[model samples]
Target: MSHDALFQLGMDLEAHPAPRAERAAGPRSTTQTEDTIVAPVPARDADDRLDHFIEKQGIRCAGAHLIIDLYEAERLDDLPYIEETLKTCVEEAGATLLHIHLHPFEPTGVSGVAVLAESHISVHTWPEAGYAAFDVFMCGDAKPEKCVDVLERAFRPSRTAVSELLRGREVA
Candidate 1:
């Protein structure tokens, strides 16, 4: 579930205790302030694309080279196989895998970020709904598209949406 939904559910359950309606309500915490406890909410603006958002969020895009967004994989459950398969594909493509991150499934989605020597590979999966998203980026001679093809073959999803990008270029 989304953070909001989970928080709301907790509040609702606390508000209406089961079986014992006469039970006293829990004490409210008055010490927490939004500014002190929470990260600043990002203002929604027109230019909130992935790169821009990443930049705004203070995340360093490893190599500032290639960025590929692959959406519509089968799910997160297929990751172990995908990881093994991707290892071969990445090796063949000349990219080195530094690390892999697999996040828990969320209401928005289950996403994972892979840190790579050439760049990075990020995967997000929704096994319950049979959907996933992936990213492979690299610098120098690493062919990220090969990784994408391997993912496509492994997942065999209904459809795939891809966005390939070359980052860090400047206007002449």
Candidate 2:
């Protein structure tokens, strides 16, 4: 089938809502009460071009943003460590790291960002609460999930909550 045909098929599938049972059986819920939905996107053939499909489908951006909450993180106050881990996460996600910047608060806590060719990964820590907020956004062929392992290993949070969003989706 042509790229436009395949893209149209995907749009048609998305337009129809899934059955309640199918939606409920998606990814398990974390500490948060809300259940995460995992809808399957139609796969492209080997010869199909991703950019063409996205363009034909009126998709503004092929990207994902992962909003993560790290509770009881062990190294919330470690600036250097957080910076290194952010860089590592970008690398592990197969994203090219353009630059990294970190700022340490007066007494404790840290904030950092790792700019990537795909997008960016950032974090803000609150040592007093033993918590950290992370935003991992990536576009193109980069896999954002690859950075999850790095965050878990580095922070050692007692409880982690994650919410993912497909950014720049088709409006109509």
Per lDDT, the best of the predicted structures is 2
lDDT of each: 0.53, 0.72
* Tens digit per residue, CA lDDT, model 2, 70-171: 998888888778877887897788777767767778888887677776678998999999999999988776778888889999999999999888776764
The model with the greatest TM-score is 2
State the displacement of the C-alpha of residue 117, model 2, in Å, after optimal TM-score superposition: 0.8
Provide TM-scores for the models: 0.52, 0.64
For candidate 1, list the clashing residue pairs, or say none.
Answer: none
Model 1 weakest 10-residue run by lDDT: 30-39
Instruction: Estimate candidate 1's alpha-carbon lDDT, on a 0 to 1 scale.
Output: 0.53
